[model samples]
Target: MLDANIKQQLKTYLQMLRHPIELVASLDNSAKGRDMEALVLEIAECSDKVTVKLDGDHAVRPSFAVAKAGEAGRVRFAGLPMGHEFTSLLLALLHVGGHPPKVAPEVIEQIKGLKAPAQGGHFETVISLSCHNCPDVVQAFNTIAALNPAFSHVMIDGGMFQSLVEERKVMAVPAVFDQAGELFGSGRMLLEEIVARLDTNAAEKDAEKLNAKGEFDVLIVGGGPAGAAAAVYAARKGVKTGVLTERFGGQVLDTLSIENFISVKETEGPKLVAHLEEHVKTYDVDIMNLQKANALARTDDGKLAVTLENGAKLTSKTVILSTGARWREMNVPGEAEYRNKGVAYCPHCDGPLYKGKRVAVIGGGNSGVEAAIDLAGIVSHVTLFEFDSKLRADAVLQNKLNSLPNVKVILNALTTEVTGDGTKVNGLVYRDRTTDETHTVELEGIFVQIGLLPNTDWLKGTVALSPRGEVEVDAHGKTSLDGVFAAGDCTTAPYKQIIIAMGEGSKAALAAFDHLIRH
Candidate 1:
């Protein structure tokens, strides 16, 4: 059922359709199958060039192929497409209908040059329709398939495919898997990173080639706001600067809304991430995306030798660890089992998908309280649970939470289990420590807003670490190591805000540049 406004928009968007696009739906007589057929037919009715063909012989009840008329489908989407994925579906239609690829030229060339395995590779991108970052990952893989015929890509809705999500242990969205390995971590990643992930041999070779250029003047080890800021600053100095990151944007991509980023009144995590990447790309910094620093050591020549997970090594004169933090999990039963199914971490990323639904926010801290207030505006009702006797959030945040009519707060409640029907989350079970009474709250989703753990586990023993495992750094973002620096949430920075991280990253870059000048 397409709304009038949306149908009109689609009709306008499809007005310039150069060629016919086909939706080859593989469906049986099941409910999901019938729904899939209806969805495909609805999409086709929007444009004269679009058509739907039903194939009932497939083993899978609800799978589909999207391609041009009389052409074999190169892209397939399994499971229902809704929420954020609806945007992905519309974009896919535009692409397959003869629109040009929006990817960079070098990226297109690299993807085109990718050679599939002898038997061909079947790439699967596990995504939650609600994830803001998931669409880009899907678009990148689909574009790659469009550019190169050697490979094909399928997009699976993580929420609908609960068994597959569990089997993959998908804690986050955009979890890609292929014969090669997990391309990047479970989050938003640069498109080049996705391409590099699918072809590690080529990536390793690229890393080797880059390293052969001798030591860099400054090497930033993370791709968050701070690392990106540092990269921009250092590269502007006309020095050989390189940045190594598992993925760009770091925790920023996990965030949903930003009202205090300075200057901007409001923005989303992914938009800011795009700005960060765009700003970094304006410089000549050698960005090694999808690369993690496995180990760090000082070379005999007074340079830093950074080993990657793929066994590649890069040498730099100065290094900055801006590795960010990840959301803390509850570790309760069914929490991990029903991650995307009903248990979510980033309220900003997944909140819209649960609009008008009952949800719970775990934790009484500022993050949890803030999430409750935020979700109250989108969802029908929000239940806030805190293990402490009272809320630990700032008085202002507590006041905001108290003012929300759709939110209910529970103190001294210990979450025991995330109740689900082996498919999606349905309710949450907890116990009141004060009365020793158990309570089960019926809700479709639960948002865990505990705290964040620093991403410095890989740097253990190499750099000075605090008692809490955060990287110990000086005021100038300098680590105990003479030529190394650290910043952002991974460091000893008192604040973990986006603006603070950007400032810290800039400081770290300047410190590294100063060290280079001194030596």
Candidate 2:
């Protein structure tokens, strides 16, 4: 993008110096000295100048790839271009920018024909939209588009443009088409393969409009434990898999600490998310990040069309719903403000990070008791606050609580305010419920073991849901929808344990496999 203000001002200045046709004609890849563009490029780069460093053999090396006019021109990266990196897109942008990204001469010729260069340029979706649980495809498009102004990059929402999508006959939402409306690629397309198409001129814009079918061996939704497990299984089984999640990590990302995930021993949520991301990257799974399924429909052919937020459609033979739940909040003041900073819901995820620290555990249920007991082992002190006169946990847990020296159980207590040092957790103000007495409890982190809400609003119309809105699935994790399957805490499973979620995820994957194979 040109400097917004400067871009506007320069657009005016350029308009004064050159007309639209002159500017349009000057856009050829053969230019070395377009005075107006050169001036604009220098200005854009100077103002939006970002430093890019890529990991090298031993140390980080600097690369100035994108012209100041573009982002990560050839230098700065969108993020770490590791596994599922957008390296090709970066190269594409360079090709389109004056340098004209080099495709085989044939591919270049084909691409030139994909769009009438006169209609101006091509449209691209760069940078995978990381909306929520996801497959990050846009990243590749963005990296290339940012560096080359010839391509207009957009973050996709599968539910927004039904007309453009239908005109292109888009079967799977992420399908990239050229200006001529020809399908370029779907799923994880290799840079070379796509580049090859640039010159093929052979593939028509409406090629997809003619294809009769679209299917997936397994389609796992949600990117939490269950969805991740399902993806790894389906991929290893040689099943053509497509994993879609609005975000890569579900509520799990907000988890601060996790004490039990099997081999993990103890870890933070982000690290756990990173590990899962690494695990899934090993196979041929299409992970869509930030792409939400707006409506799930049964196509005439019986496949599923996962309509995304941007009006794109993705089809699959079997679908896995792993969208998980979120922690229930008290909705108290300061609670929302210090969410990740201090206020937390899972003690297992963030416990150790606050070692030798003071934390308050709310509620007197099994989770609250468990959190207090767990925190007692790592933090300096554990303050367990209960609104009732006594702990409502299991007798055994209550008995164990009495034996803990670092745990403090406060009866009929309610949190009034959270006092923090802006950057981190500092202290809190609490009140005695029975006597209506207010007292200040100096604390650092507050673990609220209240409740949780499942992320399944979009599934309600398609699948049967429990009173709480969780998708109702059978023992094998099969939903009421024929080809639709679900897993993890999002199901009606009673215990929200990590191992159980993984087990259910595997079950859903296997069940989806069976369904896909049988069909």
Candidate 3:
């Protein structure tokens, strides 16, 4: 089952294993079981420290577990771990075989110190192979399971087990569940976030530590492309640079594919974000991830102070606001109530859940039209609603959308309400702009692709903002506040693209440096 190139790579990675490991397969007479057996056997051939066992008794059929030799496995895969999960499988193998993980030493120690609840903790994550956000969640749980025996995790492929997915009513990828109930809904999450959720005193401890941090010369408020670029530029100037963000990568982490990133021919969002974080790490920038900024103000000393949600304050001589935008939501009733139930923002991640079911794509821009075209293959039918008189998508995309038999585009249609059964979406309500008539379409899912809204709500009274809530910045990326700057989608930039954001971030960094020197 393993290709020659993959086998060679596996051999090289396996050389790092310090202890023997076993690939225990739970198989049946099905083709998938045979494939699993073959994969395990081929994996065993790659290294002397690896072995395979076929007499596994896992509950999930055609499943496998990667365990240290002679020990019970805590991490299991219920389906073939390919696509984005291929790396997850490799990491599980290496980590289980005594190869140290790349996580911080403190985090590793924290994981080891964690104690499960009285009922015990067993996390089960439902994921799709095409999902870009699932790998991090899977690897996180696996890492915890490897470090602490009190916790165990299983990665269930939703595509492979449709019945289980329907039973759980999971409409999105990376849905995590514990024994009590849903641990985390669909989204990208980090190990730190997971640990904080379980460890009750973690937030207070983290806040105390953050409050003790020294002042920075240049502090960035986000960790997207803009924040990352600003960090690199500021750190190169030999100043104390720090990046404070709720999570690195921001909205870009939800993005699927990028073909217009300048020199790079093609790449995935997570892959690019990984490279961005790695590049930033090569500098002297201090990265503080998984921390949200709640407010901004000027200190008595004239330095800028950014407050965190946990009541911790960080002071900096110069600040750059790169808090990027997020998907614009339709404030209609039932939309927020049924967010992950049937309403989704990312088509690439949640489209598979609505396979063979009817759905609606709201908006007429490139994102909406592209979603319709992509969903045509998986969904039974796609009804696209555009409020404008005509589609705003590119001509090429419009033409392609028109060719799909499963997709139907309606112009001059305004979405007024989202109708659901209190649990999941069942229909949609819209109005005809020309006829003044209302219509409802019964569907199982709704994909919102209208546009992005700036994440500058926290800076409303602190900075001069445009009507659209974007930070009003000059050509030099300088905001109205002295020693303060803004960039990327959160600012009044003309275009909202990755390349543009990076350039703006660099410009803002230089402007901040010049201001520092002048002061």
Candidate 4:
């Protein structure tokens, strides 16, 4: 199953194992089962410390567990951990084999201190191999299960386990579940976010710690490309800098392919985010993740005060707002109710879930057309709807979209309401703007790729905003407030691109520093 180069890489990684490990597989007589068995055996051949056993009687067929020798397994995979999940598999092997994970010391301690519920903590995450977000969540749970035996986790490939996906009504990637019901909400989540959800006192403790921190000379209020660049520039200027964000990588984490990042010919979102984080870490910037800014204001003492959702208040001499934007949602009735059930935003992440199924793509812009084209390959058919009289996508994309045999496009069509059975999507309602007529199309999924909205709702009254709710900034990235600046998609920047965001962030940082010295 693994190529020669991959085998060599796996052997190198296996050399880091401090103790012996075993791959215990439960397989049937099917072809997939045979493939799984061969994969385990191949992995065993790479390291003497690794052993394979095909005597596992797991309830899920074609499944396997990576366990320390002579110990019960806590991390299991119900499907082949390939594609984006390959890293997760390697990390599980190394971690279960007594190799230390690259997690924070406090987080490791937190995992070790978790108290399992009376029913025991068993997590099952439904994921698609194509999803870029699934690996982080899988690795997070795997790390927890490996660190503390009290918790166990299983990674289930939704594409392979169609019955399980239907039973759980999961239509999105990385859908997590526990004994009771849904554990945490779907989408990308970090280990800290998962722990905070499990530990009731975690948020309070974090808030207290944040409140005790000293004021920063250049405090950034986001951790996307813009925020990272701002932090780097500010720290390089010999100023105390801090970055507070809900997550280190903003909407960029959900992005799949990024080919227009200037010098970099092509790259993936998570990979770029990792490099950005590593570069930021080389500076003296204080990086704080999983913290949401609830409010922003200027204190009476001439300092900017940013309050977090956890009730922690931080003061800074100057602040840069780069909270970024999120995918705009369809405001129809059933859209919100069936968000992850049938209504998804990222086509690249969730396209695999609807294989051989009919789905609809809303919007006729570049993102929407691209989504329809991408879905046409994985899904049985795609119906694209546009409210405008003509498509807004580029000529090249429009031509390509029109050439897809499995894709259909409709102009002057407005999405009215998403139709679904109480559990999952069944159909959709739309209106023909040209004829004032309504129509419904039966489908299993819906992909919305309209646009993005700025993450500046919390700064409504504190700063000046455009009619579209974007932060109004000057040419130099200066906001309405003297000491406050804005950049990235959250600001009134002409274009929302990674390189543009970084440049604006650097400019905002320099502007803030200049203000500091003049005062």
lDDT of 3 by residue, 66-180 (tens): 9999999989999899889999999999999999899999999988999886657788899988888899999999999999999988999998889989888888888998867
lDDT of each: 0.83, 0.61, 0.92, 0.93
Error of 2 at 228 (Å): 2.0
The digit string of per-residue lDDT tens for model 4 on 1-519 reads: 999999999999999999999999999998888998999999999999999999999999999999999998899999999998999999999999999999999899999999876657888999999899999999999999999988999999898789998888888888998867654568898989998888879989999999999999999999999999999999999999999999998888888899999999999998999999999999998998999999998899889999999999999999999999999988998999999889999898899999999999999998999999999999999999998999999999999998999999989998999988898999999999989999999999999999999999999898999999999999989999889999899999998999999999999999999999998
On TM-score, the stronger of 2 and 3 is 3
Best by lDDT, which number?
4
TM-score: which is higher, 1 or 4? 4
Candidate 3 has a TM-score of 0.98
Ranking by lDDT: 4, 3, 1, 2
Report the C-alpha lDDT of model 1 over 1-519, residue by residue, as the tens digit: 567788888888887677999999887667777788888888888899999899734444578888878878878888777777777777778877887677778778888898886546667888767677788888887887777878777888766676776666554567778746554346566678767866757666876775576678898899999999999989988889888888788888767679998999999888898999998999898877778788999998788988888777888889998999988888889998888778988786667667778999998998899889988998999999999989999999999889889999999999999998877898999999999999999999999999999988888899999998899988999998989998899988997899999999999999999999999
lDDT of 2 by residue, 1-519 (tens): 234664455333332211111001112122322332343344334322222222222111111133333232322222222222333323323333344443346434543444324443454332222222112334444434443345544333332333444344332334555556555455333333343344343323223321333567787778888989999988988988887776676766655568877787888665687888889989988776555676888999777877765455778888888888877777767887776566766565445445677889988988789888878997899889887898889999999888999999999887888877765567777788878879988887888897678888887678899998989988888889998888888889888876788899998888888887787
- Whichever of 2 and 3 has more lDDT, that candidate is 3
Pull out the clashing pairs in model 1.
none
Candidate number that wins on lDDT, 1 or 2: 1
Model 1 ranges off by over 4 Å: 1-65, 76-83, 97-100, 104-110, 113-129, 150-197, 200-203, 331-343, 348-360, 373-383, 394-400, 403-408, 413-446
- TM per candidate comes to 0.77, 0.50, 0.98, 0.99
Model 4, residue 423: distance off in Å is 1.0
RMSD of each: 5.2, 16.0, 1.2, 1.0
